[model samples]
Each structure stands twice: as C-alpha cells, then as structure tokens.
Target: MDPLLPRPVQDLGHYRLPSWWTPGAPRWRQALWLLVGLPLLASELPGTPWRQWLLRLFGAQIGAGGRLKPRLRVKCPWRLVVGDHCWLGEAVWIDNLASVTLGDRVCISQGAYLCTGNHDVRSPGFELKVAPILIDNDAWIAAQAMLAPGTQVGAGAVVALAAVASGLIEPGVIVAGHPALVVGRR
Candidate 1:
C-alpha cells in the first residue's frame, strides 16, 4: 500500500474522497458543492430561510430547526451529522476529513475551526490521519476556536474565543487560551 495515502485508505484498501465529496467519487461533486451549495447557502445568509433547504439538498444531516449560515465550509458533507436547533455561524469550518458529529443545540461560532486531519511523517511518505470529532449537545465554541483532530467536546462546554484545543474538553466547562486548558466553569 502507498504510504502517501490516508491511514484509512492504507488500512482499508479503499480511498475516500478528497475531504469534499463522497468516497471514490469525482470532482463534479466538489464542483456541485461549490456551485449549488455555496450559492444556496449564500442566498440564505441574511435570514433568507433557503439555507436549510440547500443543506438538506446537498446531503447534510442537519436536524430540525438547525440554522447554518453561508460560508460554512464542510469538508465531505456526508461525514457530518449535526443535531437539532444548532447554529453554525458564518465562515465556520467543519473540516471533516473523517466523521464529525455535533450533538443537539451546539453553537459553533464564527471563524471556529473543526479539523479532523493531520499528517503522519513516520511513514515512507507523509501519510494522512483523519479522525472523527465529537461535539456534544449545548456546547458553545467561541469565535476562532480550533478543535483539532480526534477531539471530543463534552456537553454544555464553552471553548473561549481564539482558543486552540487539540484534545478533549470536559463537559460543562470553560476552556481558554492556547492549547485550550480549563479556565473555569460551573
């Protein structure tokens, strides 16, 4: 197996799409996403009410009453499962190189980054490791917060603005600063 491939591909003998489409699919999916999805989402940005329809049309598992703004980048919409009453703010990136599950009522603020892929240079060629991210219900990830690969944010947690979390953040807690350690909570 080629070490240049993703870990899943190397181990499973199959290839997933380039973080923007379904596995073994073509570039057309990505194009359609850009053309159709982007336009629809953009159109609904100013509370136009068309965003939900567009996201559902593009195969996002968005729950009822969930509002997603335009410019919300989703890498592989198929790998995303967002729950009910959630709000994904403008320019929020859900870079689901693997599966990313957001539980009910999760609020991913503007400029928040949820990334699930990394490079493993230990291999012959630098291989990619794409893990899943889980953000539990009622979580509030502030602006510019970064949730790194394989991270799990528990329910009702608050990741402060500009914070970077590469690991798990406990439930009902508040995390701030670089590398995102617990600051305080109730």
Candidate 2:
C-alpha cells in the first residue's frame, strides 16, 4: 500500500460515529417511531392533534397549539422540543442528532433543514460532531433555509429564504445569504 494514495473503502476505519448519544428512545420505540409514527405524522388526513399525539407518544415535548404540517420529518422526536403555537411547514426536516428546541411561535418554513450534526472536516478521521440548535420565541426560518449545528436563532429573528445560518443571530434582525449575515431589523 502506497502511503500517498488514499486508502480503499475497506481500509477507511478512521471514521467513527458516537455511541454515547441515544436518540432518547429504546430500540423498539425508535423502530415504532420510524414505522408507524412517521407515516401518521406525515399525513394531512390525521390533522394536527393526531400528529402531535404521535410525536408525544414518541417522547417529543411539543407544547399546545403547535402546528406541524404534512411531510415534516423529525429524526428523533425524543430530542425535539417545540413550544406553543409554533408552525413547521411542509417538508421541514429536523435532523436533531442532538437536542433541537423551538420557542413559542417559532415558524420553520417549507423545505427548511435544521441540522444538529456535522463532520469535523479538519480531522483526518472526519469525526462526527453534534450540537444543539435553539430557535428563540418568534424566530422565523424561511423557506429552504438551513440552520447548521450549534446555531441559535435569537428571539424575533428572521432567517431569509434559502440562507445558511450558523452561529448566533442577534435578536429581532433579518439575516440572509449563505453563511447568513444580518440584512435588516425585523
């Protein structure tokens, strides 16, 4: 094997996924969540109440009056926390490898992705890294936007369409563009 050549697929043993973090549910519960809970939650026919009930059953801490639209995908309900009157639009994917918390009246628009897991590119092994995401009260994540690991969307902040948000967003401001920047005040 040449030292300069990139290793074959079988030789790539450097990558390691963390075993300490559980999805906050037992194996059976996780299986049930994917098999039954997801389909029900993704259906419009079940309505908000039924969908909410399914999430609750899977251990999500969803507050009263929250509205999750059809096609919403939550990686782990047990690691999710949604506050009252929050709205999750169609095809919203919360890849909460760590905890994801949404405060009161937070709105995540269609096709938005909230990711709490990333790879450490600086490391040769490309280690998995996990961090929580927090969207404060009245924060709005616009359509197709992405909130990266460890980001905090401040109270009343607005992340504009298709933006990539990372790090902290100041309270009551509008941010846009890739690697989102403050565009204006709310």
Candidate 3:
C-alpha cells in the first residue's frame, strides 16, 4: 500500500494484508550487511568495499563517494537510505526495524548506533515497537553516539562523541552529552 495514495484508490487497490507484505528480508542482502558489519565491528582497520557491497545489495540509495566502514550492522537493509558522500564508521549499528534515512555528506563516526525499534513494555502483548530516524545532509555523528527512535538530526549539525540523541537536534548546531543538547554552531 503506497502511503500517499488517495483514500478511494487505496480502498480499491485491494485489501492487501500486512502479513502478505511481511517476509524475512533478502538473504543475499543480510549476508552482505553481516559480511561488512562483522569485520568493521571486530577489526581495528577499515574495509570500504565490504561495506559498499552490503549497502548496495540491501538497496540503500547510496551515492558515489560514500564510505561505509566494516563495523556497521544494518537490520532490514531494504529500509536504509544513505545519500552521496556519506561515511559510516566503525561499530555503527543501524537497527532499521523501521526506516533510517541519512542525507548527503552525513558522517557517522565509530561506535554510533542508530536504533529505530524498541519493545512496547507497556503493552500486554509486549510487541516490538518502531519509529523512523532521519539524519539530514551535512550532519556529523561523532564517535560512540546513539540516536534513539523517531529522532531527527538536522542539516549541518554535529553530534559529539558518546552522546545519546533522544529527540531532535536542531540544524546547524553542535550537540553533546546524553540525550544530546545543543552546544554551539557547527
């Protein structure tokens, strides 16, 4: 079901159930993401091809001059979108149970995890919860940072090392500390 479809068209398109759309993501893609992610996570050095292959195989909209380091682990590879000139550094785990969007020239440094899913502990079913994470162009996520669910990192923003990003990081600013707070201009 296309999200933007007109209501009448949506209703007429056939009542396609969610179960029909659900499937384990492509195996080849999973292998690719893991192939690149494991080495980057375990090793001290960088492997560009491995990372690139994974991103490409998983259908990410990665542009030329992009460098995804080996340590990045991306779940549901098909849901990730990375733009041109982006850099994903070591130990970057993107748990894209939902969607994770990265704009052009974005830099995600070492040990940064972009988590998009959580458990709905409040519900009796204890189901998996999800949200979208958006990082705009020219953003820099420094070493060991974590971006929580539904958070948006604006353009030209710099999130400092070891920061925990919970909400929105405004555009053109520098942020640091847990639940990252605006610090200065980027």
Winning candidate number (TM-score): 2
What lDDT does the true structure give each of the candidates?
0.80, 0.90, 0.77
| TM-score preference between candidates 2 and 3, better one | 2
Instruction: State residue 181's C-alpha deviation in candidate 3, in Å.
Output: 1.5
Per-residue lDDT of model 2, residues 37-68, tens digit only? 87777766636887888888889999989777
Runs off by more than 4 Å, candidate 2: 1-14, 44-46
Candidate 2's TM-score: 0.90
Model 1, 1-186: lDDT tens per residue? Answer: 668866532332433434542342257876888777765564435662566666666666778886677677776776788899999998888888788899999999998999998766464444568778999999999999999899999999999999999778899999999989899994
Off by over 4 Å in 3: 1-46
Score candidate 3 by TM-score against the native. 0.76
List model 3 lDDT by residue over 67-167, tens digit each: 76754677776788888889988778888878899999999998898998775554444455678999999999999998988989999999899999977
Q: Which stretches in model 1 have alpha-carbon errors above 4 Å? A: 1-28, 42-45, 121-124
Candidates, ranked, TM-score? 2, 1, 3
TM-scores, all candidates, are: 0.79, 0.90, 0.76
| Displacement of the residue 130 alpha carbon in candidate 3, Å | 0.5
